[model samples]
Target chain A: EPEVTQTPSHQVTQMGQEVILRCVPISNHLYFYWYRQILGQKVEFLVSFYNNEISEKSEIFDDQFSVERPDGSNFTLKIRSTKLEDSAMYFCASSIMMGDPYFGPGTRLTVT
Target chain B: SQQGEEDPQALSIQEGENATMNCSYKTSINNLQWYRQNSGRGLVHLILIRSNEREKHSGRLRVTLDTSKKSSSLLITASRAADTASYFCATDNGSGYSTLTFGKGTMLLVSP
Candidate 1:
């Protein structure tokens, strides 16, 4: 069972600093997505990527957020400037046929 | 705007008992997916039912979708303590992409 993998299981950063969360989706998957869970809140969609461009994004994915598939295997989400509200558990997911999506363990981002 | 909303925010059951969680969505969707998330972890894909399909099953998990009513239910049979987690329903609103909007999850605690 190949699964999505994310780096830096947990991260702590300053409020004004930049943070880049990295994910390596399943090798053969064509669609990739990023979602966030704010502590006890529901998981929220951030962005979706396919064919090397963003397919969709949520309001939470504002000016500070950007996603890129810098290479064949890596999908990165960069926050230009972090805020306290940006602290959450970020998950990366991928699907092969737009059916069941497989998720990674997630990266917990903590901004202080 | 939240696309999905799950009912009965929390549930507790015995190991041998069955657990049922219901999900309701606000709009038409191409597919509905159920996911399980252990505390402090990312979501694990459970099952997916297309709008055209009424029911689906995998192992002890059964998922039913009623597109006309815009609702879905997830049933876990013969539960175990390991089944204690949060279950969420996500919907892809026929956007022709993989961006999923998720609802607040139902927390299940199965005591052994």
Candidate 2:
């Protein structure tokens, strides 16, 4: 079974630094998404991408966050400046269609 | 804002027992999906039930969706200690968008 894969399984960064979390979605998938979970909290939607553009985003996906599919397989989430609250497990997901989404193993971001 | 909320935040059951968790969503959805997460790990997709479908089963996992009630339930039969993990319910609002809003999740502790 083909699965979504993310790079830098864990990252530690300074509070004001930038961090880029990368994901390689399934080759044939047309839609991609990013979600985050604070420790002990529910998973929160960040953004969704299709046709190399952002299709939807949540309120939490504010000025600091941006997503890019720089290449055919790579989908990345960039945080311009990390805050302590940005520390969480960030997940990348993909789907052939909208109904069933497959998730990656996630990248744990730790900002201090 | 979260679209789904799961009931019984935590459950404790003995190995071999059946475990059930409920989820309620605020709006109409295209499909509802179940995922499991082990301690500090990535989410593993379990099953998905579409709005027009009432039930679906995969291996030891069973999921039922009640569109009229905007709710869903997940049942794990003959659960083992390996099943001890946090289970989440996610909803796709039929927008043709790939984003999934997840519930707070139910932590199940299957003791041996």
Candidate 3:
């Protein structure tokens, strides 16, 4: 089965540095999303994208966070300046329809 | 608000036993989904039960939703050690490409 794929399975960056997490969602799926799990915490929603714009976002997706579909196949999440609290397992998901999403093997971001 | 909360935070059972996880949500939802994540890995979609549907099944997984009570349950039958993972329940409002709200998840350990 086709699945979402993410690059850089693990990322380590300095606290004040900028980092970008990349994802290639299923080719035919239209809706894409970003979610994060902070160690043992719940998986929290960051943002969702469709029709080339952000459809919905959570409070945690603040000014420092942004998402882009730079090209047809790549969805990227950029953190302007990373914080220690930003360290988490970031997952990318996609779906052809609403409600049901297929997730990728997450990228573990470690901000030190 | 914590939209989804799962009970029995951790469970351990031998192979061939059945495992059931329960989830309750705070608000109305259009659909509920179950996902499994191995230690430090990405989420794998297990099943989705819509608000209009009471029960759904796929392979060894069974899911049921009670809209009136805003609760759902996931049952894995005759599970194997490979089924050991953290199980989470997520919900969406059925809006356009809505964001998913996830629970803290139940850690299931299927011992051989």
The models' CA-based lDDT, in order, is 0.92, 0.93, 0.93
Q: What docking class should model 2 receive?
A: high
Tens-digit lDDT track of model 3 for A38-57: 99999999999999999999
Q: DockQ for each candidate?
A: 0.80, 0.88, 0.88
Q: Candidate 2 chain A: minimum summed lDDT over ten consecutive residues — where?
A: A94-103
Identify the runs in model 1 with alpha carbons over 4 angstroms from their true place. Answer: none
Q: Report the lDDT tens digits of candidate 2 across residue range B1-103.
A: 4588998999999999999999999998888999999999999999988889999999999999999999999999999999999999999888779578899
TM-score of each: 0.97, 0.97, 0.97
Interface RMSD of each: 1.1, 0.9, 0.9
Across A1-112, the per-residue lDDT of candidate 2 in tens digits comes to 8999999999999999999999999999999999999999999999999988999999999999999999788999999999999999999999987768789999999999
Candidate 3, residues B31-91: lDDT per residue as tens digits? 8999999999999888888889999999999999999889999999999999999999999
Q: DockQ-based ranking, best first?
A: 3, 2, 1
